[model samples]
Target: MYPISTPSHAKLLRPSALPLHDRGGGARTVALVSPALGATTFISGITEFDPGTEIPFHSHNCEESVVLFEGDAVMDIDGREYALQPLDTTFIPANVVHRFRNVSHSKPMKILWTYASPQATRTLRDNGEIRAVALEHGKQ
Candidate 1:
């Protein structure tokens, strides 16, 4: 038997309609599907990286998957670098150190990402600072 609200209606979300958040180091994020949007199992979003910019090395509490949406990128996983093209996808396990860098000097790069857990947390490798993935877009 299903609960009264067990079957929720599907939602149509447009990236252009969502809010863009600064993630420092020339990176910005746009949260798409999440608990705030009634998602119960996982969370998804898109991240845009400015030209010649990269995010700091960090790991998540759960597995993560990312697909390159535009431009070229270099994904560093566990200290090894892998070149990525548009539509290239990667599945990263939990607690693995990784980061992404835009290889182009003029064009920006974008990636669509999803976390295995709804309540995911990230820990920076440099200072061990922890933060909730859901709240990432809420901060300046």
Candidate 2:
């Protein structure tokens, strides 16, 4: 077999192919870009959020680290609120409760989330989270 650059292969994908979700609450995410590696690994693409939109308070069964690329945010984790801006990196311990909110109106929030363990994603995708019926609102 011939070899091709990873970037070349990845570029063949159209954004429309990504599975989007807004089933839970505020903000939206495209799952295909993140392409889960397993129950415990992945490099996620962009996660977009609207101004003043919050991810809602929730806890993860595993650890998560995110890098902000665009706009800014305030992360509330374990009772402390930390400001996050473009290029900022944050970490959330396993089973810890946390949330992200878009604090800018003129700019949109984008983040690169890496999961040490995608416990939630597995549940969501395996249990009809990506099913047609679960898709609400247009494309996240």
Candidate 3:
């Protein structure tokens, strides 16, 4: 176990410092920053999508919460689309198929993602059709 720290001992990190996985077409992700810094119970990171880029439909076993920090986001949850703007937060239950896309033509969309598990697992949908966006480094 790692030693618990006081609030003053909290660590600050930039998204670039974390392990970034390319999802192709300018979509990228960071992972495990929480546990890497001794956090327990949950893990968190960031995902950035460039204009005209998106993540393929997938489902995770763990619940997810995301906060849009920049630009515009169009989230397709269970086949329904929701438009998200800055500071908007969304919660997704486990085992739900969802995807995210950047709606802006010239701006990038960035979101902070948090998962209940340290290593969130996602199953990508493969239905004999080519995927527009690949998985992030072939991972969840």
- The residue-by-residue lDDT of candidate 2 on 10-127, one tens digit each, is 4233435655666354567655322222222543445788777776566555567888888878998777899987899988776566778898877778887766633333223123
* Candidate 1 structure quality by residue, lDDT tens digits, 86-126: 99999999999999999999999999999998889999999
Error of 2 at 33 (Å): 6.0
Candidate 3 lDDT, 89-125, residue by residue in tens: 9899977889888989999999988878766666777
Which residue pairs clash within candidate 1?
A: none
Please identify model 3 stretches exceeding 4 Å from their true place.
1-9, 16-20, 127-140
**In candidate 1, how many Å is residue 86 off?**
0.5
Q: Which parts of model 2 have CA positions greater than 4 angstroms off?
A: 1-19, 23-26, 32-40, 121-140
Name the top lDDT candidate.
Answer: 1
RMSD of each: 4.7, 6.8, 5.2
TM-scores for all candidates?
0.90, 0.64, 0.77
Worst 10 residues of 1 by lDDT: 1-10
Q: Give each model's clash number.
A: 0, 0, 0
lDDT of each: 0.88, 0.59, 0.73
**Candidates ranked by TM-score, best first?**
1, 3, 2
